[model samples]
Target: MNIGATVVFSVLFLLVTVLGFVAAGWRRGNLDELAEWGLGGRQFGTIVTWFLLGGDLFTAFTVVAIPALAFGAGAVGMFAIPFCIITFPFIFIVFPRLWRVAKQRGYVTVADFVHARYRSKTLALAIAVTGILALMPYIALQLVGLEVAIGALGFDTSGLTGDMPLAVAFAILAAYTYKSGLRAPAMIAIVKDILIYVTVIAAAIIIPGQLGGFEHIFAAIPASKRLLRPPTASGLADYGAYVSIALGSAVATVLYPHAATALLSSKSGNTVRRNMVLLPIYTLLLGFITLLGYMAVAANVRGMPEFAKYFAAYGNNFAVPALFLHFFPSWLAGLAFAAIGIGALVPAAIMSIAAANLYTRNVHLAIVNPRMTALDETRVSKLVAVFVKIGAIAIIFGLPVSYATDLQLLGGIWIIQTLPTVVFGLFGRTFDPRALLIGLFSGLACGTWMVAQQHFKTSVYTLHFDGYAIPLYAAMWALLLNMIVAGALSVPAWMRGAASFTGLSGSGDSLRDEA
Candidate 1:
């Protein structure tokens, strides 16, 4: 870590800290209730919402992981680019209706809407727990990315024999977040996004020229190493896997609670529509970043133990910074490093907020004390926000990089399983509450078992399925099973006078006969 880089990062850190405090005033009035504190007073306009959500979506994990995948395995990382690009259209189509219904019914979290519609606290709670459980590991992964970036570019790895550095960084992030709420992250995002775009876009242009070009870099790899695992020899990645990952990721992307919160925090349906159109340009930037991996390989930046090691000697988070430092002036490299570092802060803060909200509303308020007041919810949420930050710090310390990345992917699969309820319940007429529960459980089980089966390397859950290697990413498949079961159950349910879920008279809240 050079003094130039250190000073650059430090100055940006101070700037973000100031932004956090000032953003607290962005709301229309004082943020007294939990909703305002947690959701930016439900009044974020086009600008704040665009930057805030972008800051959240273009996360640290994406920064490190995407290029690593491409560098580690060619052509595969492109999946992330398309997946991100395609997701906005999906969001535009589905979430506007979701937002409309939520606004009409005054719903906050997706679980709130699910519970009211399905009339099943059990089902809603299951979905909520999956989301929070899945998200914590993802948040932890972001810390890992930040650690890599800092160690590579800023921190001297000597004398730091443990997780102490990561723990300290997370404590700082948590402290500011607790003081100011979502407003802190939103303000910081403005700077974070700007720095990231400048750095990544600059790298995309400069690195290729430094390494001759993409064709030259890719030509260095041996033909055999490009093939898949033993018992079969194919391209390192197949078309099926590529398409599956891309499509699956696109669908799964919008289903994430944090992602949804980012979308809902927007000002209006039109804002979401407009943002969706412009969001793909970021995907083009990601595609550029993914090329850095091959560029590193061609630049002879690899063949070292643990990709991060090779990325070090200068900076471990080198997908972007390495390229910048390699080809640009020293001061410009330092500026690029600063942007990625600041980028970590913005989303890490929001993720910490989203996790805290889940714990407060879905788990704590629902289970511990159903009768809690608005002020009580606010207090409880702040406390939980503090603890979630602590948990994120712990994750940074405790988990391995490889394991952490796997968990984040598994989180996507798990969170995506809740989609039918969220996407379907908005307008589906025959979907009875009881039927939805049975389907949800069945799908969840099937998906969990599937993920376990496929994740032979790092995951914990697995089951054999028709002579195929499958583990992790069962959320969609499991939910498909859940839907089938729910449909079957609804028939008998209807025959047996299961309380009609539709055509309610009075207030739309009085599903009294089910009692």
Candidate 2:
């Protein structure tokens, strides 16, 4: 192990661990209430919300996988830059209304809003279950990033002994999140974002300088690797896949329960809108981070004897870590690794809390115990948060990282199925609740089948029509099928003039009030 690097990493990790616990008292709220514990009393201002959402969305997965994708798949991996860019407009236009409704209704999760809008407990359950399932693999991906960071520090990460550090790290994460609730991740996110910005800025300046500038870095890459493949007469597979992933991902990004948790925690709808405008700064940071993959390719880190084993073991996931280790001193590398590690923790905490909130509000309370008190609900959520972390750790230990990636792909597909009921519902559209439920089922089943047909190797599926082949995101295809089914069935209900389907509480007035 590099002793100096390990010391720096340890110190930084220790500092955040302390900060996590201290955050319970930061805003001074009653921890026994679900609103206080789950949503930070809906009290976060624009800056805190910015940091929280930034840290929550731009996770360790972003640090490890974006560059890795660029390193392996070339220009196609740069889709994430556009993906981030596309998502914020959706946030700006759609989510502030959601925040207003959630704030007024005391809805803690997307399912809570779904329940009120549709007035169907079953539909709410479907949304809740989908959120939990989608988040499990996402939480596990954080560990994948953390594992790479820890291994980069020169620690063994193979067997039971190698897994102890991950366990210990998550144990601390679970404890603080259970104690401090959303505040833990919200407070730690400030530090996590600073570290990430520092690391990215330093890498931007230092790596290119060492590599003889961006011109030479691009020169080192083959033309095929530097640019996306053009569309051919037979198909637009590459172009379609790029556009579909970007659009599908943009829609799916805000739908994640954790994303909603961050949005609802903000003090006002304007806070969400303001943060949406400022969040693009991270997109610029992402562009810099994505270049690290090309930097790794230029430096030939995989060919280095010291890093060859890591490449063999972790595949492209090690590219960012390997790049840091090669060019920087042990101390600086440690700082970068800590940034990645803490990046994992912030998201992991938020994801667990979000999942827990869903289970407590939508599942446990709605189905299992309608009479559960607020204090009891808060206790259940806290306990569920710990169990959620434990379950995520189990995923990291029991399965291969590829499994987590595959599930996360499906997670996006699964979560986007709720868009009609959640996002469209915000517009005061009155769809038959049963039809919406069927649509949700259709999308989930169709999306899963398409992904399975690809053998879980990719999220894009190709359609062969006449002689031309068209490729698109499975989620988008499934969503189309869902809307078709729901829209068709909803026509009957609309024609009947059923007042029950009109809006929240069977009246369009509540929705129009916000309008």
- Residue 95 C-alpha lDDT in model 2: 87
Off by more than 4 A, model 2: 498-515
Q: In candidate 1, which residue ranges exceed 4 Å CA deviation?
A: 154-162, 221-237, 303-321, 455-473, 494-515
Q: What is the TM-score of each candidate against the true structure?
A: 0.86, 0.96
lDDT of each: 0.70, 0.93
Over 1-515, each residue of candidate 1 has an lDDT whose tens digit, in order, gives 56776677778877887777777676655565776777776677778878887888888767777777776666655678778867888888988777766667666677887877778788778778877887887777777667666765546543446456666666777777776788888888888888888877777677767777777777865554344333323222254455556776777768777777777666577877887878777777777777776676676655444445535542334555455555767666767766766677777787777776777778877899999988888788878877877777666556556566667767766766677677887766466677776677676667666666666242223234565443323554565677788788778767656445554554345767644
The number of the candidate with the highest lDDT is 2
- Residue 60, candidate 2: C-alpha displacement in angstroms: 0.3
Give the per-residue lDDT digits (tens) of candidate 2, residues 174-264: 9899899999999999999999999999999999999999999999988888887778889995899999998999888889999999999
The whole-model C-alpha lDDT of candidate 2 against the native structure comes to 0.93
